[model samples]
Target chain A: MAVASDTIAAPEHSAEGRSETIAFLIMTAVLIVAPFFIYPLFLMQALCFALFACAFNLLIGYVGLLSFGHALYFGWASYLAAHAAKVWGFPPELAILTGAATGAVLGLVAGSLAIRRQGIYFAMITLALAQMMFFFALQAKFTGGEDGIQGVPRGKLFGLIDLASNNTMYALVVVIFLACFLLILRIINSPFGEVLKAIRENEPRAISLGYKTDRYKLVAFVLSATLAGVAGGTKAIVFQIASLTDVHWTMSGEVVLMTLVGGLGTVFGPVAGAFVIIAMQNYLNALESWVTVIQGVIFVVCVLLFRRGIVGEIAHLLRIKL
Target chain B: MFEIFGIPSNALFSQLLIGLINGSFYALLSLGLAVIFGMLNIINFTHGAQYMMGAFMAFFLLQYAGLSYWWALIVAPVVVGLFGMIIERTMLQWLYKLDHLYGLLLTFGLALIIEGVFRNYFGSSGLPYAMPDSLRGGQNLGFMFLPNYRAWVVVASLVVCLGTWFVIERTRLGAYLRAATENPTLVRAFGINVPRMITLTYGFGVGLAALAGVMAAPIYNVSPQMGSDLIIVVFAVVVIGGMGSIMGAIVTGFGLGVIEGLTKVFFPEASNTVIFVIMAIVLLIRPAGLFGRTA
Candidate 1:
């Protein structure tokens, strides 16, 4: 009877695995082809946010940790990358690495402090710390204060391929996003990922099972922060700006909105969310605060009746992983 | 001029008064948060927005109804408190079954909507609320000067804080609240309407924030973004004080405010972040908070 039950569960697992891979392939194809029809700038922005949201999802979805202040990581990286590119005259890729390193260091400090508290306190601690950084950025000289680091030269790729053209920059962004996305996929399926899920499902239980859950959480946080930095750094190169807006609490809320709208725990939810939200902001730019109002409504709606989100619901209906 | 630690007495005293005023706001705000969290088991993220609304309410009362500061002080919180009750009944109640984080998220969304709407209508600039005819002047305390309105704010805040503390920690009604806080399910079995209590508790807590807002209008510019900005600092105050105790919240709120004021006088660059720094240090030394007994 036990073997029969296990066999049935095994087929369900295989089906989910198969569907997940299929979805990723479809997503990849769409991402590659989407730029042809859509405006590349808008597409690139959405992709950066998508990658950012995906990194955010890795912590919240897999580890069940909702970081309310991810903008710190995203914004700090953008600033570092922009400063490195413009001032240090580094190559584009090296600038991005510098940004990622900065974010990792920040994550180490922030994650260490934040992990000391649990649940709601954790969210508040991250927010307060981020606010502290925001104040720091406001006072610090290198960030250019309110004006931010503007006119950041995209420079060359590995000091060879010129990236001044929009097309080259777009392609580079796409490639970097894909690479990071795949790395996220790889991490999510690893033993480390399983332990993260275990910790998320029940931290006390995971701890009882001899897992140093804090270390796992810290590692996941650093990974998530580094990737978010990658997205932010690339964004700075693409847009040639890194400003206070990126580090603001509103930006943090925006990422959370994207994750919530797409699907909290699904593979492709952040991608869908980023596009939908960015598209809304893009088209509704004339409407100003209405966009904010609309986002708020979506948040309320998402929390109340539709927690599964667009991708999660679709995945659930299809009996497949997203 | 006399000097304390090489700083002039006047500068120190004036800054201390500023800190006390700031701490009063923090105390009032954190007190509301603690009250709400005690009963609802959810941190009120919409608190800042509601406080902003309270200021707006007072502004509207003065502009449209020709109400005076005293009238707005009495009326604004009541009006805003009702709105809070509506939100509690309609929205926040639904989130009780889920993780406490959802409550934070929902309130945060509400805050965005409220602030966005207000920003759309009024813009981000601060609107000055005129002081009353009786409270326009200042008093010389020999070494330092004190504005009448500022002095009133400190006194009024003290009354409210102590009144709340007295009611909650002393009265018979307080016993019921304590019972509900300890175990709602057990209390509900004794023929009490626990859900209604929860809603009212949320409303009362929100009312305290509105009261603070009404008080704050004359001191700070009544801006839409005011509450959201202050709330983060209040969160740090709550963390440092430990949200578990009313007295803890009040004491820490005022103490940190003083500390922040002193930082401004000594190291102005660090003024904005000193509270957060202290919060970090507190988390390291006492993860639960100074007064917090539980995790």
Candidate 2:
């Protein structure tokens, strides 16, 4: 089971070589030109969510782990970064790093706790833990409960470059998102990624092969959480607010939707998925009340009929590795 | 004058009673989830929504049909159970051959739809469900005054949980069900209609949630969001108890409830998070859960 599943690792192999070069060029061109066709802020938001979803995919696709509490890391890190920048007057870059570090620590604790059980139990454990954090945030003084930590200052990037300007901020976001995306791609192509696939396919076999599977899962989980935090923290800087919405269970569900719609386990699928879903959400936000129902319908349709998702199906039809 | 750790005995007992009451609901919901998982191998993410539906069904029954709580007790489960059958027959049955996670996703979608529609129609605010007149008022229990309705909820849930255990563990039908759960193909070879049984099993599990909902309506306000929140806590209870044994689920549910209640008295700040803390500790101590078998 481990060996057969390891074949999926080959996809990551191609992802690192020429494919990555093409992807980098395309993404660079898009980032450079996106502001001309679209609002820079909207593009920044999409990029943030795209990075969040990709980080999430690292766990579900490669490790076959479905986390229902990812919102905890995203939301908590956002809160941390927001507090640092808004209250403590930290630079934007420092705030982002604070958020990422917070996520890594949270991921370590949550991952250690969740990895005790496998499969559905793991998902439920993470979800329950996240809910605990939700309650903590609800009652904690700094969170401001329903009001949340609002009107956060973006501050200058590295205490030099002002992010008050739209274009400057957008460029900063693009740089961060691209770096995170490339880092994820690199990690997935490495031997570490192959081992993760091995554990996902067959845990006992991987253990028998003398691979300390738990450590790999923990590392992947922490990495995923840290990246998700980066996205959330960046969003806080962009929007100048970090609220309960980021940490809510619905946010976790939205990440799952992005990954599923994009293509689970595919490198670029989550990014594309994030763009499509965010665009759909932007359109649906106009209706406001009806959005939940629409989201529900999409979930049903996706699970039942479109399981392989848009990119996965396209890849299959084209016979080109996604 | 009597104090336990600087807290009044009355306060502690009252919290313990509240804990027991919460535990009863947790036991009922987690038991339902475990039973559904047994045969279907799918976590019924819709269990919470179904529980909420039960409360709504009761509300509708009383408002439109002029039915009493007695009638609701009898009719609500059947109504929700039938709904469960429909969902299983049309959507869930098709996914049985696929990964179990798909079932979780599908039910999650169903839950969102149900909760969304209800929220859209009723708004997020809770509706009042009057306790039956007979179960109203309080009983003087020496140390603490126990609300009759609260006491009844605990007893009733206990009866239902035990009754289910009896049916699944002792009855010939239960034997067949267990046989089917272990090896559906082999059980089918014996001419048992395993698919139909599977559908009904889902109905039965759903019915258990509805029963809890009916029991809970008067205590907690009948709201669309009620079940969704409670369901996550119950999932934690299920994890702590380890879904390996029915008794384990029941005991853990009630035990955690009491523990949470005690936390409320000792450290009110941590009341909401005590169960999760316990869950983390349990994971560290016994990863397979207290009664769960090592895979």
Using TM-score as the measure, the top candidate is 1
Q: Write model 1 residue lDDT over B9-92, tens digit each, in one string.
A: 999999999999999999999999999999998999999999999999999999999999999988988989999999999998
What DockQ would you assign to candidate 2?
0.73
| Whole-structure CA lDDT of model 2 | 0.89
Chain B of candidate 2 vs. true chain B, TM? 0.98
| Model 1: lDDT to the true structure | 0.91
True contacts kept of each: 0.71, 0.63
Weakest ten-residue segment in model 2 chain A by summed lDDT: A11-20
Question: What DockQ do the predictions score, one after another?
Answer: 0.80, 0.73
lDDT minimum window of 10 residues, candidate 2 chain B: B286-295
Cand. 1 TM to true fold:
0.97
**Model 1 RMSD vs true structure:** 1.9
Q: Please, what are the lDDT tens digits per residue for candidate 2 over residues A113-171?
A: 99888999988999999999999999999988999888898787777888899999999
User: B175-266, model 2: which lDDT tens digit per residue?
Assistant: 99999999999999999999999999999999999988988888888999899988989999988888878888899888888999999999
